[model samples]
Target chain A: MRTLLTGNYAVAEAVKLSRAKVIAAYPITPQTTIVEKLAEMVEKGELDAEFIRVESEHSALAAVYGAAIAGRRAFTATSSHGLLYMYEMVWWVANARVPLVMAMVTRTIGPPWNIHTDHTDLLTMRDSGWIISMAENVQEAFDLTIQGFRISEEVDLPFTVGLDAFQLSHTAEVVEVPDQQEVDEWLPERRQSYKVLPGNAVTIGNIGPNEYTAKLRYAMAKAIEDSRKVIEKADNSFGEKFGRKYGGLVEEYRLEGAEYVVVMAGAWCGDAKDAIDRLRDEGLPIGMMKIRYFRPFPKEEIKRLEGKEVLVVDRAFSMGYMGIFGMEVSSVIGDVTNVIAGIGGVDVGVEDFEAMFRKFASRKLQRLEWWPREVFS
Target chain B: MLTEVMILSFGGQGGVTAARILALAAVNEGMFAQAIPQFGAERRGSLVRSYLRLSDQPIRRHSSIKKADVLAIFAEKILKIVEVREFLRDGGITVLNAKHGIAEKSYCVDAAGIALSLNLVAAGWPIVNTAMAGAMAKPLEISIESVINAINSTFSGELARINARAAEIAYREVKKCQAGSST
Candidate 1:
């Protein structure tokens, strides 16, 4: 059914449709509404699930991790500080190879105290063994979330679906929710590779010798790398079932024969596409490469841009280095223009992108620049 | 065509809800719409701004509206406090929740008076959002039936009926004015 929903609410709806067995989350701005709606559903008997109210974000993920170990489909959501608070548990969930889903409403980590959108929070987990995917709009948020469960379980890895803090979280748009029966058929019951039963004796996360630990880490590294095909398969299956598929891993918009390509992720890609369309109308050879899955980093897709004049727009900076995504893209595509903008949720509109592409096409932009300039100055 | 709408009101006046209702109504009318509430640490009675975009095609731009094609002012006095004129595009239609029309190419509805008559009071303040949403339909180029359905879906039973009634009255009683002359 087509209904109006915010990105947060859309994720919650997907969780309900996925028949998540347990939901434990500590409420934070942007992310609060997601769990709030789930809690309401659980309360009203609309969804049959245990709405676990934990004291902190740490306990929230830990509870979900525990639930997942017991072979129950589980979910947990958190934002900036809440995510940081659950940092240790993040590694624990990933290393344990628990199949669970987390909705990460990306926000800026604060010193001046902000509750706004930024990619830094989610990017910080790039090396943490979790499958990370970013959604560009509310419908994609819903699609990626439902896909997260199947993809995670298929790879026996945890998956995190990210949407911009307020830009996507609070913004409401039309989302076509699939029927529960269809979703149930698409996402079958959880099949656990290993479970922590009461009668079984198994120790997870036990201290091991250096070589053993290194080997386990290597296995995890390989699993995430292998998950690339699983992610693509999940997206294709979802598209086949629901008639909506966001080009697997990375969605390229008007990149054919383009001279300048803007590569980025998150909600702003919608605005970027709008700007790109206008630029295309003016006959400018510019397009956008939206990174749908941030990790395992979509290396193959990034490699496709090897010969293009790429401009990487990163909402998260890597302090003393370049933008986190910029660094990654540059490492693959050689030295391309890396511009950091929209940090702390400062609005980057169509006009801003239009001007940036214009400057980029004219070769008037620097190799590394911070939007609004004063942000770094 | 894309019609950008800016809804300006104080926090607690249901500005965000108004945006949602407008967007929902647009969707019900078979158009794509997006409702974006300006994000900030806002408190009650402080200024609040929300945006709505109704388009024949999917809305891909998620940024806050820079220039609005339709400006809906929930409270008339906000015009004094904020330079709202800068945000409205030239020749854009203004929908004012006022007793009298104040601008050319504008529509006015006494939303507060309509709300109070309908006893739609929340937190001791008149609930003028639905009524204003009703007043905006004609200017927004959306059918009043869609607005009524949206209000009905957003509320329940008696509340929905009263709110829909308020919108109906506003739709019928809204005054279209030209250069300060109310019609």
Candidate 2:
């Protein structure tokens, strides 16, 4: 059925549909409403589940990890400072190989107390060994979340679905919500391989020898690396069931025969796509590639940019390194233009992108430029 | 084409609710709509804005409105903020909850006055979001039935009737203004 849902509520609805048995979370800005809605659903008997109220973000993730260990499909959510607070548990959940799912509302970290969109919060967890994916809109928030569960359980790795702070979190859009029965058929009950059953006790997360620790780390890495195919399988099945298909790892828009491609992720892709279309209309060869999954980086799809000049537009700058996204792309595709724009929720409209395209197409822009640089600022 | 509407008013006046109701109305009509609130350290009397976008297709850009096709102002005081007037796209329509006229393609209605008469108050101030939304719907070509239905769906019983009454008055008043206008 079609309904008007905020991105937060859409995630809550997805969790309900996914039949997550355990939801543990602490409330925080933007991300607060998602768990709040889930709590309300649990209270109202709409969704049968245990909603644990944790005192802090660290405990929130710990509670979900505990639930996962007990053989339950678990979930939690956090943003910005909350995520930073849960940093220890993030690595704990990944290292322990718990198949939990979390919705991360991306926000700028603050010394100035900003509550705006940025990728820094989620990007900081790049090496935590969790499957990370970002949604471009509210519908994708629902879709990716539903698929997140199967992907996470398949690999026994926790999954984090990232959405822009208020851009997607607070925004309400028309979403085609699928029926519960259909979703149930699409995603069967959680059959965890490892369980903390009372009679069958086994040592977990205990100190091990150097060789054992190394193998465990390698196993975690291999699971994430092998997850590329599992992610695709989940997306394909979801598409067949719900009639919506987001190209598994990356979605390419208007890239055919294009000379230049702008790389980005999350909700900003909408404006970037609009800018690309406008540039295309003006007879410029510009395209867009939106990265969905960041963990098992879609190196194959990105490597396809062999002859094309790629422009990486990042919303978060890694201080001395400039944009983290640009740095990562550079590691793969040798030379690329790094444009740091839209940090702290600065509006980068189609007009700004159009101007950038004009400059890139005309060879006026020579090197990496931070938008709203000292001059524009 | 996407129809972007930005609602400007003081906090506690239902600017965010107005955005939600507008999006709901659009969705009820089988169109795609997105509504977002401009979050900040806003107090009761502080200025606030909410954004809504409606389209036959999904809305892509989630940023705050830079150029809005329709600008609905719930407070006359906010008109002093230059950015409020600057956000309107060229040849765009403006819906104001004020007593006086403006020099553009605009419509005026005493939305707060109507809310006050209806005794709809939140935080001791007359709530004008639904009224402003009603006035906005008319100028933006949204259906009165959808606005009223949205109000009914968002609220219930006496409170719903009070807001619905305020919205109905503004909707009829704005229609009368449209009927009387030459431009």
Top of the candidates by DockQ: 1
- Among residues 3 or more apart in sequence or in different chains, the pairs in candidate 1 whose N, CA or C atoms overlap within 3 Å are none
Model 2 residue pairs with clashes: none
lDDT per residue as tens, model 2, A1-377? 99888899999999999999999999888799999999999999999899998899999999999889999999999999999999999999999999989999998899778888889999989999999999999999999999999999999999999999888998888889999999999989999767896787787799879999999999998999999999998989889989999888999899898999888898989877888888888888889888999988999989998789888888878887768888888889898888888888777777788888777777766567878556565
Compared with the true structure, what per-residue lDDT tens digits does model 1 show for residues A236-280? 888899999888889989999898899999999988999999999
TM-score of each: 0.98, 0.96
Using lDDT, give the best candidate's number. Answer: 1
lDDT of each prediction vs. the true structure?
Answer: 0.90, 0.87
